[model samples]
Target: MTANGTGINGVNGAAPAQAHQAYQYSKEPLGNPRPIRIVVIGCGVSGIAAVKMFKDRFHNLPVELALYERNKSVGEPGSRTVTQGNPYFSRVYVGAPELYEYFKGRADAYGVPDYVRLEHKVTDVSWNEKMGQYGLKIEDLATGKTITDHAEVVINSTGILNAWKWPDIPGIHTFKGTLLHSANYDTSADLDGKVIATFITPELALDLAPKGRDTVYSREEQDKWAEDPEEFLKFRKRATHILNTGFEVIVKDSKEQKETLAMIKKQMEKRLSKKKELIPKLIPDFALGCRRFTPGDGYLEALCEDNVTVRITDIKEIVPDGVITSDGEKVELDALICATGFNTGYLGVSVAKFPNYFMTTGPAAPAAHGTFIPCIEAYIKYAFDAVERLMREGIKSICVKEEAVADFQEHKDNIVHDFVWTSTCRSWYKNGTVDGKVWGPWPGSGPHFLESLAHPRWEDYDFKYRTGNRFQYLGNGRTIRELEGGDLSWFIKKGPKHTREELTPSTVSINGL
Candidate 1:
């Protein structure tokens, strides 16, 4: 029910409600332009968007924008990876089309070319009160050389997945075969005839098996067995393991293997039979939506291949050339693909250490509500909040309201317990210090998040505007009144709901809703 109303639980769909607005004031003509140098810490979607926005908005001013990245090219570990094909087409969010259009428009409007100082890894950040800026020390990941940069503002868009964490299973090093995380899963061609085991999340079941088994028992028969719990469980267990679409082999002791396969097949059948009923209860043992669901076009189908085996065995540790399970069995894997994901080093300390910088863009930490929507929503809020802070105060530089940072973290911690998703202990999204306790952001819905970020909340942040700078925040008491207003309001002040146009891929043209 929550999902239906919210469209997706956590996504905020209605237009953003109003907060206290900033007071607007007119200023006299500016004299000389002030120089503002900004350093954006990553070249991913967030960094690129921020750079372009700055160029377009502050083109006439003495503003210098520099982007630094550790990857040689754009779209590194955390960047947008566009997968081609009809199957992968839907992976890109619907909100992405608008984003593309926005970026394209900004690029065209400003002559600033996107530049990245690639192969640079940021090592440390130190605060300098004398300079009123944060100093960043970085190491060139390629050559191992150190570099430093200081700017009026520093944005850490250096996203999650920058570092990978491996399971601390003993004898892991002894396993002679290749061991890699899921991030290293580049292709499936190597899985041709070798036996491979993979850990798959239940969310990926649809992608794994798109079609029902050809030899499955009829629903009528299944329903008959369902009358008895013990009988049904035993039967279903058999069905979940066996059926596959690949080559079959017959060995001398294959009877036991056959039975094992049959059990898995039966279990899978039972799982599918109860899909609708289980949707509400299907929470992961770990956090439900913590780590991103590893999605591939045909990962499930690949697992169904005869040579590939899906196991739920609890791993003990890695043995030379194989893996040992808690059940006292050893699996010999040639290459260990660590499909395990990364560790997000979410700092628990206050962002106050960084001077003059305010939270004006995205979540200071990682937040994955529904990929694109909430990210944009939260980022925009930060943007408007910063602008409003500047408008209210005459001071040019301001940092995140120290109080808001604490409140925001406390708020984030409180939400971690309410949702079943956060109840799971296993997740990269959890607080680095606490288990089953997530310090990361709560996932919000895309549409809802967009509406929330539409308005600026001036009172929510601590801001100090600078009179030394030529720019000032200009605010009108527009109480985010667009959502409640009817057709009359649309006529009065042409709102985005009426005038917002979709950007087409071909030419820059507005297509109305």
Candidate 2:
């Protein structure tokens, strides 16, 4: 996950005119400055990306970067954390296995181990106004020691899924059965030939249930799907069709919603034809795409198994042997799995009240609508751009403007109304908000988010200069290459340049008007 090359011109090539104007306020040169201290919390994909971005962009500069992970390894104790033992989970490109490999490779290639501190959990983060920096208190989980550190910049990449909450059910402790959350679940060996009952909504139930034994793709088939462009494209097209249809059903008219449901019913009927009676109990009554769409796979088929059962009734209590439902029915079960979803209230990128303290993958992040890798890549680029500005301008602190945040929230609120996430359904996107505020899902397409992140809105930030003068960063008006006696004629070298294309309206008559 490399940056999309949007900030290269601002950093390496000529600065844009707006940037020049922003620098014009600087009064003095940034002479012999101290190394910028940056602390990144969490060693997941986003945190690793932050480390990689800082290293790639400012390796030669005076920058001290530190990364801390609470888990024993880089990725961690969550379901998405892929260790060597479990190399695969989820089919998305940014799934655990792929991300673990990608970030780990980059970390090794860039020698990031020198700055990485595994098993170090950031316990608290607070602003030290007196020191004009962020104070971080970290607990060394392995050594049982506390460490205090200060940083000019702090990045929180502890993703939303880090904190897992179990469903609130009475007498849960009394249950003698093997109970576990989906996050702790790995292989299905324990579930084999057992009476299993999962407490989950329709979306998650469909995702976890085994579709059918034959539906499992062979290694060679999966390899072919990855290797062949045409096959991949066909798969993408089908997926896109389904996603688009789901979106239409949620946002469009009742008629279209009914038609889409009928279509889905037909497909479900074909898959679970033998257990037709279970269709009404398993399928959702709400509109499609109202909540996140979980791939059904062989879920319908699994429910049809004689030993397994799908219970949509609410759980009243957990008994010694099984679960008691709202209808006073006690179902005997050897195992109880809680497949309830994660807390999504905090889903987008956010700046803590303190300046220069930023977090990623929180509410309103573009990952809600697209592949997470690209979205994380975009955020890294955006965050680094701000950091670069701070370094170049001799700025002491930079914080997001209140108006900018308010405006962004307003825009997000308005856009979700046009999407299915605004429908009357309880989901992670809604974050339990009664007002129907969508905390997840980007308002636009993936590419749109990428384009939007191409440049940071510099005006949307308030900066404090080291010298108490904003123009202090306009450093002697000399490039680093020129100052260091490097190749001065490099700009004269032949290269492809951006040329403006002029557009003219066609003069042809329209329908002989």
Candidate 3:
């Protein structure tokens, strides 16, 4: 989505110098701060955060926020973490259901649910150039009613894992079994002793299927965490520090990566010692953390079970009641679960051709390197910074310039080329392909991603102001600071951290117009 526009030099360029004269106001000061209508799609963590930010920061302004969510209630919208088998303890560390509650809880705590339009699915969104607004086609899931809405600003907080795809295979429909996509799994379907063939692995059912590993913390430890708030905070900080500092292990050809890989390989090989043949077939050859690496607790032991059979053969096709291997062996299965994958995206706060649009958690975000919470907050703040600029400057539309997007992409590609994610391996990071661009991770570590978005470069955007000129916001060569009760000396440094009640030996002030 390449857009052609000048940053601040061409026809749409900004010029503070109003050659003719300054704007003169009639009634109000700052002359009616342009009323902005903002629409948010997807009530995920990002969407919820956007609403909370609006309440916290955009208050007392003419900003209207409407959030549309597809689900009955707010929850974490998308990801690999939602469907992975065995609920890995170290990586894929938390349960999907629990994660859902956490996100929903955050929103509920902030009263963000009040602003949400639940059961409202956004079917399509497009920017109307003439109107200078984004038009959204929405469908209410409850009544099957469709609606069209427009907003001056649109935020797509819908994370990448929303779109799930079935693996393209011949005669897949012929399989006479309960087929399921991980994103749309039916929990009621009984998998007890059923011969399940999975593209990835099975779901929570396998978490404790006789051959399971249970990790239990001591009662005293639990009480300590529950009783002492400081203790819990300390633990969280320690865990975050570890995850953040371990970025070197994902660096291409780094000593840390090599050492970490060897340690994990030895541990996995030991776990699979009973069924040694599976080691060669299951163990990866690529760099560690290249794919979604999880400690599959009891997975190896389950494979060692009597009924468990491992097949590394390619699937020729699926016939009635079974799958035909490339080696002419037909394996029977009661169910087929395609944990195939989702359509990831190349995302930044704004994209070309989409004016006044923002994405909270997109494919290009720093997802894999460490904890995602900080990054999500950073993304929201970065996006709203631009929004604030538009509001303050009375801008109608602001789109990231084509050159800036191109440069960011180039830098991202170059940096990713040296990361483990871009190694020769089939991964969702590369859009479920073996050899393509890495789409699901930022170019650098999570901190780097956060740092990059810390400040927005104003010159990287092309903006069209509401009054048709950038200087229109200059507003009559007068400021509200000149009005009664306004702090005229706010620019001066406060005495000793604002300790002084008044300036010492104060001189009489004059009101000059």
Candidate 4:
């Protein structure tokens, strides 16, 4: 469709011939901004940051907000959305408890808890055409009752890691040993002298003690960071710069990818010196960055223990004793842990029919790389900018054009194969399909993603006005900004700079010609 398909004219996509119905407005003054009710789902990192933005960063806007989180407390029940690591931390690794405390503290600091509805789950949402708002069906988990609510805007941040999945192995539930899924692990389970099998990281299958774990900050270093803010800022900048610019590393044959492949192979081989036979099984043949990679401080050494047995073959069945391999061997164990990863499909979810809202950190976003917080913050800012326009202007509904989304999808798909995620490795980014669509990340670098979203394409959206006469929002020939004592002449600017001779002798030059 062409750009003129927005149907911006009067009723029936046609303009009036004359002053139809005498302007259809009373010419009242455009007073203070209208109140907008915004509902945010999931209180993970995205939800917390969104709340902070609404409550603290955008206090001036007339916004009514509510945050719905499924978890009753800060941490528990699937661990929600914490993932990956950052370099700027005092240590490279961060635990779930620390992240939970950090978000909890922010919730208290900004008084976000006041607007949070804990233990509430949003089951369904649809547009209420009559009321010009969104209708939501919510489930109160504690009461087992469904409730109904309405909001002008809904921001879904439920995150992708909430759903834990198990491998589709036959007779999986027939095992007699204590079975565990990493996402829903039981902390009280005892494994002191019993054999354990793991389908994920090797360290989880054994009691092999790590030789050394030094991912903590020294006393002096911590003191220095506390004493000098500049040092901290410098370190943060350096780390963020590296993270923001490392997008090229995922390119299939890029120099960075080759270097990373060599480095990872060297690290793994050195750690597995005693058991060289396991190297071929553990080391992946595909290029690096095709899947999520971490430093894994002590994971390699833990796998080198004498008692540890690493299996890479496909599972045939889950016998009463243990897992049966395709090669006809049954490995006995007292416990089994399945770190089979999450059902990450929700991370990049998109619903075409839904209106008056958009996803943050969604598919085709730069979220798959870099420090995720920056990406989350950027997306929130972008989403709220639309929310501001909807509240400030007399807009009934606004959503991206179908053609625009199609174009974006086609463009992203054209360039996605250049990255490592589309290589010969199975990844959650592709929903575990080796050749499936890549939807979890932007096709460019982190900075490029930020810059592109900094300026929203207002024309790419279809905006429906609240009034019959589109110009009714002009209202009394006075704007809210002007009423708030802003500079009335702000739109006026000096003309282009001209030479003195050209400005003074225009008449003489005409006469001579």
Winner on lDDT between 1 and 2 is: 2
Off by over 4 Å in 3: 1-12, 15-27, 77-92, 201-231, 481-513
**TM-score-better candidate, 1 vs 4:** 4
Candidate 4 residue spans exceeding 4 A from truth: 1-22, 26-28, 75-90, 201-212, 346-351, 481-513
lDDT of 2 by residue, 1-513 (tens): 111222221211223334333333433333434467888888777776777788778877887888998876664423331111211223432233444565577667766677789989888877665455777889999889999998888877887677666788999889887887775565544767678778886556654565234223357756887788798677766755454343345554557767877888778877777778876665666667777554356667776777665566789998999988999998888888888876654534545235776777777776445346667778777767767766776666676666678899899888778766777777767764434677767777666667887877777666655653455565666656655677866645443333345222343323332
TM-score of each: 0.59, 0.78, 0.85, 0.85
lDDT of 3 by residue, 1-513 (tens): 222343322344442444676555434456446677888888877787787878988888887989999877886644323222222233333445556666777888988878889999998887665566777889999999999988888888888677777777899988889898777777689989899887663232233233224454456655787898899678677766767888898899999999989998888899878889988887789888787663456666777777778787678999879888899988888999887677776666787767788887786877676666678788788778877877777676787778888898888788887889988777777877778888758877777887888988878887765554555676766676675457776666523333356534453223321
Clashing pairs in 3: 23-476
Candidate ordering by lDDT (highest first): 3, 4, 2, 1
Q: Give per-residue lDDT, candidate 1, residue 7.
A: 13
How do the residues 1-513 of candidate 1 rate in per-residue lDDT, one tens digit apiece? 000111111112112222465534444222233466677677655665666566556655565677778766443323232221111223332123333444445434443245567778777766554344567788989888898887666666666555656666787678665555554444444655554555433432323233332233456655666667787666544532231111121111235435544554455444534333332233233322334433323333444454545566678887777888889988877766554445666542125434444332233243444234235435633653453333333344454445666777676566545543354345555533325555555333334345555564445433333422223323232222333353433444422433235544443434432
Worst 10 residues of 2 by lDDT: 1-10
User: Model 2: residues >4 Å from true position, as ranges?
Assistant: 1-34, 76-112, 186-189, 211-250, 254-262, 432-436, 476-479, 493-513
Where is the poorest 10-residue window by lDDT in model 3? 82-91
Q: Cα RMSDs of all predictions?
A: 16.8, 9.1, 5.3, 6.5
